[model samples]
Target: MKAEFFTDAKPLTVSKENFGLERGPLAHVLVNAMLVSDTAKGGSLQYQVGYQLVYKPDSPGKKLPALITTPDMSSFCRLFLERGKHYLLGGMLDQNGGARVDLCSLAIPWKNVTGKQHRELLSYRCD
Candidate 1:
């Protein structure tokens, strides 16, 4: 017996809002980070992260060397995004078009993703 196809089936279309890019530029990539330094000032914590880009964007010379500030220290601690670890970061671009990963950005450990998933993410259009 042969299986029947459902002609009425429709493909699901995901909206850009689902990716949380409705308000800003989205830059997603894998990175290895090293903590350069961190400081607390006026109840806010700032971290200087030295990161190496694992995925280069379509436009050359667009990737920045570091992440200057992560607004909330508690959130940063919760994620445990420490130095010497690789993370898949989904960040927004600043006024200068440099990617900034902070409390609001999505940061996941690189070890958890599969190779296929990594390839798909790398091919995604950030612009």
Candidate 2:
């Protein structure tokens, strides 16, 4: 059997002008996520995550479902991400219109997240 390794990838840059609508909220957000499932196949990994918008720079919280993908096999162990744990995640919509979280993204255990980090994430400005 081949051992899998984790890899880090840069996040996609999101501009205020094109994230969504001029009047809509920015696409970047901080979320509290519960890992529902994780599957690996064909050189890709997919996570079925249920998340609540913990903080958005300009909007109220909301609950939603997302499918996060990563081409790196090591991302699972690298982030210590696992099923049934609540995690603090920094996420954005990918080009395919699905929410994504990866090595370069901010993903940590909820208990490990600091208040300052939360505040900073909540106050981020897309502009």
Candidate 3:
């Protein structure tokens, strides 16, 4: 599968613009993980991919969810993460406390994460 499915895709920057404006505290999670599974949910066509946390630099020894939902974006753009591949994922915690990521969020392959990009992602405040 082509990792560059999202043309002009860039690493996420450290800015409030990357997060939602929803009221209440936002718990952002950024981790280096391996894509464990990818499956389309029923008829909705949305994918609920699972990832094994390989590294969580911000919150060491903290427990975090392994699965993150990917909204169905077939109409526009979609992120297709290959199982067994490592990725640097960053996303906000939804109201349900579940982690959700999409084409708009940081979902870059581990090999593609540059030193600068890694530092920038680490700079973000992760709860």
Candidate 4:
């Protein structure tokens, strides 16, 4: 697996942490993903395409779901976060001990995920 740092993703308007005495506010997270292929073919190729996204939000009493799409761009999902949701939010450390959110690869795609609709994201990550 390969990865790169992305700084151009969109994010929601909210604070960082949920409840806190420390860094209780959240920032934004941008994820840029790419796929490469060695063998070129029709409907396929020397795969080299990418996406420029915005960011993710993790504010108090506020949670938003990711609109996850597949590599083939076939599937689409939009999950929403609700209050009293439990999930992990990771990021960098600020000078004021605040949070400068980093792009996390792992997180419960849905906080209190409702239906069996977004299980694809979990499978996508396994690829």
Q: Which residue runs of candidate 4 sit more than 4 Å off their true CA positions?
A: 1-81, 102-106, 109-127
Which candidate would rank higher by lDDT, 3 or 4? 3
How accurate locally, in lDDT, is each candidate?
A: 0.43, 0.46, 0.45, 0.27
Model 4 C-alpha lDDT per residue in residues 1-127, reported as the tens digit of each score: 1121222223333456522212222222233332332323312111111222212322323332222222221222212222333333333322333233222322243334445523432243311
lDDT of 2 by residue, 34-84 (tens): 343334434544566554444443334443335565544574532336666
In the range 1-127, model 1's lDDT, one tens digit per residue, is: 1111111112333465433212222233333453433354433333334444444443455445354334445655323456555666555443443344555566767677789987775685545
Which prediction has more favorable TM-score, 1 or 4?
A: 1
Best prediction by lDDT: 2
lDDT of 3 by residue, 1-127 (tens): 1111111112344456535311111123233343433345321122333444333333355444555556444554455666556676655444444455557666767788789966764565546
Per-residue lDDT value at 101 in model 1: 51
Ranking of all candidate structures by their lDDT, best first: 2, 3, 1, 4
Superposed model 2: Cα runs more than 4 Å off: 1-42, 57-65, 75-80, 115-127
Error of 1 at 75 (Å): 7.1
Off by over 4 Å in 1: 1-58, 75-80, 96-99, 125-127
**If scored against the real structure, what TM-score would every candidate get?**
0.49, 0.48, 0.48, 0.20
Q: What TM-score quantifies how close candidate 2 is to the native fold? A: 0.48
